[model samples]
Target: MANSKEPRVLAIILGGGKGTRLYPLTKERSKPAVPFGGKYRIVDIPISNCINSGYRKIYLLTQFNSASLHHHITSSYNFDHFSKGFVEILAAEQTLEHSGWFEGTADAVRKNMVHFRSQNPTHYIILSGDQLYRMDLKAFMDSHIASGADITIATTAVNERDATGFGIMKIDNKQAITEFIEKPSVDVLKSGNWKIPANARGDLPAEKEYLASMGIYIFNAKTMEEMLDNEFTDFGKEIIPRAIKNKKVNSYIFDGYWEDIGTIRSFYNSTLDLTLDHPPFNFYDADAPIYTHMRNLPPPKVNGAPHIENSLLTEGCMIINAKSITKSVIGVRTIIREGSELDGVITMGADFYENEEAKADNKKEGRPNIGIGKNCKIAKAIIDKDAAIGDNCSINVSGKVYPDGENKLDNGVSFYSSEGIIVIRKGAVIPSGTVI
Candidate 1:
């Protein structure tokens, strides 16, 4: 069990990236604010991990399209006035000393140092907002203190194929990082020179592979202050490499499921995995539950016998006589009419429910309601929120791979196709009998 004592830690969650790879889903919201797992946003993962680990003082730094992110944070996390715990949002602002926006991750923290210093914490925990995983950060901080290291980074072992995409580290016998290389080439990894020492891994299965950085770091407050005095922009690209040469940097091995959610395909696969028989990351862990903003909606309604196999249906959904749904995630307040067959799809439920009058008005305006109509077949796609698909529509029919393409209209809905995954943007309307 992790230590239960009050921790003197200030957690900074980097939330500024404009997730271009996520495209239409991130069109209006920041990456961290993007919806995930039917009921939560991507930022909930890290925030919940922090709360679960007993670290309450959190600072979320965001810049692009931060209104939704700000609203989510303000509405979701509320601490008592009598307690010192609070989750605050520190947007990039102009001051007399600095005028530019955050250039990189390190710069984001550097620009917010004044706010961070106000807490007067002994340690600083830096985290990314777009990854999915569960961890007891108290254990991570305890390891750093036990090792007496200036900085400790969370790392995980990666196979050869996945190793090239991460910042590889070479640790000595003492489990201290000796060298750091960010996104090294296949040739560099094949040289057999950057292998981590087997004994240094501490009970983990020894393999002739690299330790990839999880982008979770703990820094002694004073050490972080001194390191940020310079103009290093990124931690992986510059700060960690420099710190390895001068400071005692140790690696805390984390052997668990962690996905960076960097691209659409990766996001699609990881989310659908939740409906599997035995998922890699389970959200039902009562001991460490993923927290999110609660909604007071009625339970899902199934009008007739709908064949649902290995699917997750969230709250406020109405499935009306669907033929079959396999390996899919139906978000909150989603409605599927009669004879609709969906497979391997993620339907992000509507933001607001439309009443009978609204549906009649939509019909008069030749628009479908804010949900799926009758006789639609959707497969291997992502239907964003407030989308209206008319009757007899087929999506991703051919299963073609489109790396990047979109049909976007001015003041209208947009459709993006990536890696054969069709993304119907929020509020998109697909007419009846349409096939794609």
Candidate 2:
């Protein structure tokens, strides 16, 4: 079953930069650690994909706000003594040679080359931590080896509007990428030969004319070392374009449910899409299941027969007499109290349940307990972990307009509004009858 000539591959996941675009979600934890699909973190997708693809030796590189991410990874992944596989994080550090934070994706990997070299991998599979997709990376590596490429980029056919936001690759009939342009303008796209060749189109849709980089790359170890030998900070902007000139670069086209959870709008839309009857991305596939920390949470409890429809309620939730819950994702250990209505909402849920003492303390402070309170109506919003929403409050109510960006309530509690959705900050407490 083993091809002795096949190169040993190691996976590298780039935990993104400050993630300013994601805003309050990335305020405390790194972007990869941000929770997704009610139960899993963003990092879990790529890590699970790697595990399913038989690549277990992985490294995640991050610099800012990594404490929660570290905790999540350590708690989730553990291999047996017989296996030489491990998932580790390589945070940016100050050494004699490098004293600054990871300037960009390429720089981040370059700084950790000393550590990765110790593992003696023959090639590297670079992935983004915040994307949602299931890929057979073993097959991807096989394609790379068969093509005898120094660098292989995973690309997906996207429409013209979406193509401008990504690095467009121009490939020949052999799937060999001949040119690379980073975020080309519309004029350049119309004027330049940026279209994929007809022979290579295969099953790609006719309207999807351009091939956009998916930020997934497989690199020969020597070629990667050579490419990172400079001060080039980024791969798309510098490293990739330069490598295209001198290296045998190829493209692997992927046509699947791939979503870059880069911005609030994209993240919101992607999460809600999971509530569909047949989601584009299936998490229930037993052959390639997504893995996360096993909290051993008990099944959710619904009392008084709340009306529920097309929602994802994770483990350890108590739904008590809710008026209705529609098209939402309720996270672990969440509590939806009596007479509350939630629609198109994503609640990250509480870390730990509030005992009697905690409830008493909350009562003394005139704040609601850590969950949605009675008779509240929340819609098109994200309730972060351990947030307390008091009774009879209105959030993102129908026909009620609210300004976007960071806004504070009269009680000094902070919440964020982006793309017309309200985001209750983690550990925030909204007092009784506060309307927004």
Candidate 3:
């Protein structure tokens, strides 16, 4: 067996972001801290992936609107304190050495490089804190080493129509990337030449062939330093663009479910995906499990609600007297009042106000009492914490719901519950029998 002399590998999680796109949810916490899959936070996915991948030395970089994210990381994740391996979180702080808010993805890493080098790992595996996917990074690293590539990127085939926001790549007979374009123009969508015989699809970009980057990367420690020092901070917009010229940049094709939950609609849809019979993600894989700081909460209690289908209910949640909740994710301690009906909605942890000290100033400030309207219906909508809706409110206001509120009315993204989700705003309440 190989001795344990291998240089420690570092998985640096990029958790710092204003996450303005996910505003109301991100207003209090960072993107990753946004509650997900009923019980887990968005950050939990990548952190869990790292632990399951056998790389215990991890660093989470977070900043801006991060109080909740920071608190979650500290209280929940406690690796073996006595063991050599551990996971940790780092936030932006001011010091003479270097201090400013994280500007971009690459800039975030550049700001934290000092802390990273201290780990002195043989390889650096960087991940976006807000994507949802599962893979064995160790195997990806082995492939990187075997191919003798300076940098390895994770890629997946996406529909050509949906390739607008993603970085597109063109490969050749070998898995080596030949040409790369960052969010190519529609007119520039040429048939990509990148092809690997071992792949399920050899012909590059055939009819619907656009290979998109997953923004996951493995870098030789030295290679990363040089890349960071060269110019810009973003790997997608800068580093990889520069490396494609001379460095050996390769791609690994992953044919699995992957979603970028950077926006509200996407976030809401992604969370809903977990409720499918065969969910796109499976946390049950013991061998490559996603690890997180566990919460000590009792099991959920579903009282009098019809048998749930295509929904995820977390610990300590009580569903009392609700006739039905179809295709939704409910967070801990959330209560669905009797006679209320829900469909394709997400009620996150702390979603209700419940007239606590926090809401003491509510009435004076016009904050509505926290409770859902009785005998009302919510479909394909998101109701934020603390703002109680009147008994007869309508969420879809209009017939159609679109991101950024396509109707351009105040209803706010009728379908988006991610960043900028309809905020009940702490302490605000809707009068009974009213409609919003």
Candidate 4:
């Protein structure tokens, strides 16, 4: 077997399409570029994992709303001139051969084969840019090489409730995956044939009968080239299933904290969970810290230290005599005025500080300044960057209050609510005495 350290590995992070499920958040930026946690972008999870696992040469394939993603990547990850390790963005473009955007995950990589050929890597690691997980890629690569297989998939055991959303698989005693089904129906799972035999279950929970694909894969360079030579557009939907019948495919079972932030509900819930005493996914790990753009803003300032419990406040925030803040993630350059109370909120904070002139202009133009206005009550909502909420406005009103689906509100930038979570659009201005 070849030494895991000796092989050259290239990491490819798949920037997802339109991201309609994460609507307003993906309205202006790509899913990966959306602000995550208090400060980092969603893309940082996979990129950080790659770096921590000692795989530095990485490429991110982007298609929709890539401008902000480009800026973020160029600004955040800067390698030295002497090192070949770099993070770059390969956007979809029309060439002489193909004149279209990335149709799916596999097609995205296939289209960028010209660039991949130059790197000449021994193995390729494919990852999802928008998921939240910290994996040791070196270990995963080692498992792939040790399995003596051309392609290896990283899978996690999930319960029946979550099984229908993922590609479920059945593996043999040798850890070789023999059967694959994408989003199998309830009746299909009830057949009891897809469940892994008890002897082959390994250390996974007994309740998690199905192994769901985590959308993470490792492919031998030659095998990837050969697989992409065809017209298959998706790995999970096409390439992978076909490869299982012809190639020796293996599964690397991962029992770790992984959350796919696909919708506004998932994003909001996962983010707020960080404020827990012990979060499922830890961002405070010193050995493998999550990295992001270093804005170098000053430390957060609390005026009177008004009630703050189970919250994360990032740099450059001014909490001025707030009544209380609980179970929230406040972003950079946030200015919470006096008498404002927030619970279960995730504010992306402002991009740039509004100067005295900007504030004067806002006042003159009959607008509130950038941030939460005074005496406002916000609950179960996401306040986007540069959102101006005027004083005495009640947002979302109650924790249980949510629209059946999506309800559009008109005021400043016309805010909206999805799955009961109110989202104030970026740069939106809610006038005084406004209520939603």
Q: Write the per-residue lDDT of candidate 2 for residues 254-347, one digit (tens) a residue.
A: 9888999988888998999999999998999999999999999999999974589999999999899999999999999999999999999999
Query: Could you tell me how far off, in angstroms, the CA of residue 222 lies in candidate 3 after the best superposition?
Result: 1.2
TM-score of each: 0.95, 0.98, 0.86, 0.96
In candidate 2, what residue range of length 10 has the lowest lDDT sum? Answer: 396-405
User: Model 1, which residues run further than 4 Å from truth?
Assistant: 1-6, 202-208, 399-403, 408-414
- Candidate with top TM-score is 2
Summarize candidate 3's per-residue lDDT along 1-436 as a digit string, tens digits. 6567564689988885688777667766788888787777888888878777777788888877777777888877776765567667788778786667766778878888888888778899999899999878888888888888889889988766777778888876567877788887676774443323345464445555677899999998988888888548688888898988969999887777788898777887787887888878876676766655466667887778764677888776777777778898887666676777778878775543355675576556654445555666777765554445555555543354344532333533222332333434332445555433
Candidate 2: clashing pairs of residues: none
Of the candidates numbered 1 and 2, which has the greater TM-score value? 2
lDDT of 1 by residue, 1-436 (tens): 6566545899999985788988888999999988888888999999999999989999999998999888888888898986678888888899998999899999999999998888889999999999989999999999999999999999988877788889999888888998888888888887857877767655555552679999999999999998899999998898889999999999998978889997899889989999999999798999888887778889989897458999999999999998988999999999999999999999989888998999999989988888898989999999999999999988887555555778554535457988888999888898877777
TM-score of 1: 0.95
lDDT value for candidate 3?
0.73
TM-score of 4: 0.96
Instruction: Give all candidates' CA lDDT scores.
Output: 0.88, 0.93, 0.73, 0.91
Worst-scoring 10-residue span by lDDT in model 3? 411-420
Tell me how candidate 4 scores on lDDT.
0.91
Clashes of each: 0, 0, 17, 1
| RMSD values, in order shown | 2.5, 1.1, 4.0, 2.0
